[model samples]
Target: MAIDFGTCFTTAAVRVEQAGTAASGVVVTAVEIENSRYLPSLVCLDDDGRLLTGRAAVQLAAQRPERAESHPKRALLRQSAVLLDGGEVATAELAAAVLARAADEARAQRGGTEPVRTVLTHPADWSPGDLDRLVEAARLAGLDAPELLPEPVAAARFHAAEVQAEGDGPIAVYDLGGGTVDTAVLRREGSGFRAVAVAGDPDFGGRDLDQALFELLRDRALDLDPEPWQRLWGDRTPASAHQRSQLARELTLAKESLSSTGTVYLAVPGYPEPFVVQGGEYRAAVTPALTASIVLLERTVARAGLTPAELGAVVLCGAASRTPPVADLVAARLGRIPDLAADPKAAVALGALTDPPAPAGVDTGADAGEEAAQDAVSADGSRRWTVAHYPDEVDPELWF
Candidate 1:
């Protein structure tokens, strides 16, 4: 079994042999949760202290905000305890609850006592410490230490096998998930792939866009009445946190709807009139993140010692990449239309189940300098840390 524990959502898959035959191809089926494959990465406790996971947790957050903990993954790097319902909740504990929920769904789907080997995917540039915490979370979730896979590597593997992308050159992966934007370059090797370069912005992606929209709504709410605003979201009020969570939930739904329409009119509670926002306004709010993602893509290619023309293909991963503005930016900046897998969100988990490439044969005829650089990158992959930089010279306004 493989689980893609996304910041905003999670998915799991189990591999099975076709018709119980040894020679049959492995078929992967998605584990269903709340009658859907996508599970919201949310955790919350009720008034009586009952634990709620996934969509249920998200719903509870709107009604009982103080007890809800959303976006726990973002808290991984912080040292302070997160305030939840007057208590401090450890980041690992919240992550464990979310992961355990996924594991439970998978076990129910399988209906067997067979010991399952689980693979969990993480962001490409996650530090060794972060990886260790993920393993601990899995363990706390009642699962053994899971095999860890980098998100982009797993994505590239899926693209190579499913798309039959035929090329010896490196493939570029543009991963725009709920909480972050990651760009990675991968070259196929014997039975596996080598990462040439990887970079990401933890503050960028769909969640950022949601916040931008939420701010707009908040401003309108304040104008409508500071009293209602204070009652719903003031720091000193009991229902303030709950109201904030409810607003966030509403705006997230509105943000997703903007993809298909010119405007999203919201009938927010306590607001005398509906809030109307144009799609263009939302696009402008998120352009900085989109621009940052393009720059990261360019930086990855340059670090790989290759021009955009030298790239085999640009593969788009994650659900947020489906947004039209992101796709347009990739085409305009990279000068190539990106290829998306069958299901971008599920690709990483599915790819984790793929076989590694066979070891490559030594090439005596290979260019000496190129081989040395490749070897260096491979070595760096096993090291504890690596730093990448985005051009500080770029104007901030250009991002939007």
Candidate 2:
């Protein structure tokens, strides 16, 4: 099982092994929420202990804002304790629920057959402790701890393999995600990807644009619904929050519309006129934030000791990678337009399962009898499920 636990989405793919060495690797990818295009990356355990995921969870959070908590990412950053109905659910546990949902999906695709090997993708800047918690959560959810990998590193490895297979050269990976935009210079290095320089932002993503769009909507919505607008200002209550939710959905629609179209014909419940906000105004308001992200990303590559002239094509993924201005942003920074090879949404998961773990213990020259019974080989030429204990090499305090 190879899983990509993204900020707003999660995906998993399984590998089925075959006998013939050449035909051994087969990749199959699946996602948790098939009904909805977007995975909310949300988990809500209702009063009945029923779990909700994806759009259902997000929808519930919006309806019953008091009982439900959404956007665990912010809480994870604040290190704030959550008081759930049954007990306190740690931020890691919330993330774990989301991840476990992906694992559950993987199991369903494989007909309940347990996966022996697994890999997990995480944000590049996440601390080792953060990685540990993710692994720990997976374990608690009944899956084995996986090989933890930075998302860009995984993407680079995936792209590098494709280029090398086709006899191609250096490439750049422009990973514009919902939460961040990461770009890496993927060059062939030692039969793998050498990320020469990588750049991204911890903040600044489609969500940033959403906020700007909300502000613009507020400017429009107030004129249309001056009564509700006045009611919201007098007090910060559930009614006000509900009104905000209704208004914000319009902004969200507008922001999403900008992905493929220049203008959004938006209608809010309070707003009488179905107004249109041209993409130009939207672009101008969000350029500063996007520019800052692009500059940071470009800086990472520039610092890695390479000029744009020496590079290859750029590859990108993440939910927001599909935005129209994202490629333009990369081109302006790198001075060369890039060739997009993979679907930004599904490519990472597809690539995740391409590489398989060589189960240790197979002896090429072993007798047929010995080979028949052998599972994996250890470095010492023996395999009895050996576990090599390396020094902890990590601070235990951080996990607490």
Candidate 3:
């Protein structure tokens, strides 16, 4: 099993035996439990070293008020702290505690065994040291460290399985999730695929859009209020001083509604009124940033000597798959966009555990399942997430 232990949200999936199957048969699947699937990448700690995860921990924070800490994941990403009953806590410890909780759930679901194999996903451009830290965190969570998977690569597998059923050149994955926007180009190989080139901006994506939305409502200039917004919005990047509050669920809900409907309505608790926003204005506010994102994708396509028309399929991942601007931009640039409504947040986790990357030079016209399972294996036995790049030298744009 592999988990997309995302910063804003987390999901897990596993390869298991097929229902009523002979020992000769098994099906690989990414599984999800009700509400158990994603806990706001948050954790709260107590003096006794008790840890909490998922919705329980989130709720516990409100009750305990002192010992229970929240947003451990955010703390780590933002280099900030939360005042809990037990005193100050580090963000890394928070993430570790969350992972610890996730591991507990994973164990229970998998029959309480440590032999379960797991893969952990990370930003494609994470410093190697950063990956090691995550591995160590997983260890702290009570399981053996899991294999590392890149968010883009997991998304590539999910997307290729969907669109490659019809046609193939290269599969372009635009993964805009709750936390980051990532994009990558994969060429199909005989069995699996390989990333020719990849790029993403850790600082951009849905989280960035959240900041833009907050700025729209806060009535403050980006320069003057940027610090506060950064604390709330840019939690994925390195920063100092963070506010531990979570986004008002209603605000994020309203912002999400604006993605599809022409207008969105929101409530601010302290205000006596609800706020309404027209989608057009929202798009306008974020256009310049998105334009650069499109160009970032174009750069990778151009480098590959393949026109957008030559693309196999554009796969979208992350919670931001619903953002109209991101979808429109992909269509405007790539000529086609794959359907992404299925748990847009968990698609990568699902596919990473079940769907393998398209074979290099794949013919987008065929169904993936029709091909033998043996076809999913790459010559090197590495998933596309094992991107081979001279990270020290290559500085491609950080969005797919």
Candidate 4:
């Protein structure tokens, strides 16, 4: 089983062998949690000091915003602990809540059997300390020594596996998740791929774009009726908090709808009617950030000692990458249409199930440590690699 613990959502996938067939090849499939492909990466501190995850966390958060930490991954990067509703909660504990939920669901799918192997995908720019926390979280989640794979490398593997071609030169991956945008350049080395360079902006992502739209709605609501808008913003009651949460969720849906339609209606709390936001207007508001992401991609490629034209392929990962403006900006800046996975959010988890590329200068033959390094897997055939152990020297400042 592989888990992609994202900032906005968590996704899991498992590799299973086909039944009743001579070939019986292994196939990777996404694991559905709570009847959804993407589980919201939310955690809430309940009255008893226990952590609630997924829908429970979301529901509790709506009623008590002070007790929730909506972005645990981001919080983990900034501090070891977060104070929620006056209670100090370890960041790793918050992360463990989400991973535990994923691991439980994946195990339930297999009739209570534990997964033979577990792999977790994370941002390529994560530092050794970040990774240690992640591993600790996994252990806390009941996963013993799970393997770690870089998000961009897993994304690149998905692209290569989907197209059945490695192509020439390095493959550039542009991962725009909910809270961050990560860019990486990877080149094939023997049977596996190696990271050439990585770059990202932890402050910019789909959430920022959502804020842009939120501000647009705020401006419109204030113009329509300043009193109600002011009340919504000023009220500290639970009802007001729930209403604000609902409004934020609606706006997110509206933003996603704008991708397929020309306009979307947003019902702001304390407002009498929904407001209309034109797709073009939202696109215009987010264009600058989108372009900045493209610039980062270019910079990462350059850092890898290559140009956009030299890239064999440019792959887009994360649900935010589905935004129409993202593809347009990427193509306009990179001079090529980036490849979009069938399910961007699940790409990393699914890709982690594929065979990892061999490390450079390692013999793939059965020679103990040499074979393990070559296959990038454990002796038990489960894939295992870590950015801390990656051959290339990573810039510490890039860690988020």
Order the candidates by lDDT, highest first — what do you get? 4, 1, 3, 2
Candidate 4 lDDT by residue in tens digits, 1-400? 9999989899999888778898687889899988999999999988888999989999999999999999999998899999899878999999999999998998888888888788888877676667778888888888876777888878888877777454646799999999888888887655667667877777787889889999999888888889998998799999999998998899888888988999998877667778999999999989987888899888888878888898888999987998869988989888988888879889989998876444446565655334234324444333444444322334322211
Candidate 3 Cα misplacement greater than 4 A, ranges: 19-24, 33-36, 46-49, 60-90, 220-247, 355-400
Model 1 TM-score, 2 decimals = 0.82
| Residue 185 in model 3: lDDT | 74
lDDT of 3 by residue, 330-393 (tens): 7776677655647777777766665554455655445543432221223323222334332321
lDDT of 1 by residue, 1-400 (tens): 8889888888888877667587787777778899988888877877776667877787778777678767777775564357788878777778888788888888878786443567778887776666667766777777675666668777887887776545656789998899988788877654456677777776677787788888777787777787866666546454666666666767878887887788998776577788898888878877876888788888888877788888878999986777657777888898888897768888888887765332246342446324322311222122121222332221111100
**How many pairs of residues collide in model 3?**
21
Candidate 2 lDDT by residue in tens digits, 147-207: 6555665665566545543344556666666665665555553333444554456665666
Assess the local accuracy of residue 218 in candidate 3 as a C-alpha lDDT between 0 and 100: 63
**Global lDDT of each candidate:** 0.73, 0.60, 0.62, 0.82
Name the top lDDT candidate. Answer: 4
The C-alpha local distance difference test score for the whole of candidate 2 amounts to: 0.60
Q: Against the hidden reference, what TM-scores do the models get? A: 0.82, 0.79, 0.77, 0.89
Deviation in angstroms for 149 in model 1?
0.4
How displaced is residue 42 in candidate 4, in Å? 0.5
Identify the candidate with maximal TM-score: 4
> Could you tell which candidate, 1 or 2, scores higher by lDDT?
1
